[model samples]
Target: MNERIEDKVHFTQYISVPSPTSSGRSAAWLAKNWHLLNHLVELEATTLSVSARIEESIRGRMLNVVVHLCNVEDDTDFTELVLLSLSSELVKIQSISADYIEREVRCNLRGRRVTSDENDEILKEIMDALEKRGVRIDYS
Candidate 1:
């Protein structure tokens, strides 16, 4: 028996920001920064997700920003954008990292078996750059 397999790779980065007191301010801030983020990343199409939630601690509300990139080559540009955007005092950035990998596999028996490896070197370089900028990466 033989099997054929296909693999695909994807990278995702998450940013957690503390929301301001007023909802209006939060909305305005996200809108403005989202535009700036798109400009900085310079991607043909932006893949950014923004959500807000209320926190029980002194930090009233929090915004969770998720950026998904289909190409590993864009890792450096995305990380640099995160660094630039988070430098603002209005938002408190909790963490930023290339912490997620999505794999798509297709297989068929009676074909051929195959294996593949990810771009670990590029990912490692991105992680190292983020660490140097004081961003702790979560490998989950």
Candidate 2:
């Protein structure tokens, strides 16, 4: 079967989910809300990742977060914008600080480049769908 054009569009955002009291609770929250992340991935109608990692705080507690984004292409500008959009979606996040980085990788096929706002709109739609599911993440 021929692949759909929309399937070529893909993006990701690495968000540092704020520490929420306990690491267990934060983990639980992520587990329960995985659908939100999945829906966000579906927004682009392509593959996406919003994975997380936990770091030890000064207090020895873990700060749970998904700290990296992996898109098919190395479009740093577009990736950064998608992350900002995610922060806006999860209003509970008070702040987001990410060091933008870019890497080149060999790909089998060429892809069209997309604008930042267009990427944001896809993420917005994903967040909206999650909201209707009682996820209530703000994508303002």
Instruction: Please give the CA lDDT of all the candidate structures.
Output: 0.35, 0.38
- The runs of at least 3 residues in candidate 1 whose Cα sits more than 4 Å from the true structure, single-residue gaps closed, are 1-92, 100-118
Model 2: lDDT equals: 0.38
lDDT of 1: 0.35
Give the TM-score of each candidate. Answer: 0.24, 0.22
* lDDT of candidate 2 over 1-140, digit per residue (tens): 22222234344444445377788977986888688667665565433343323333455433322233446455352232222223223334343222211111111111533344443444444444434434343223
lDDT score, candidate 2, position 7:
31
lDDT for each residue of candidate 1 in 1-140, tens digit (9 for 90 to 100) = 22222223233334334356678876876776696455434433333221212112234342222222233345343321111123322234555433331121111111311222223332444455445545555665
C-alpha RMSD values across all candidates? 22.4, 21.9
Give the winner by TM-score.
1
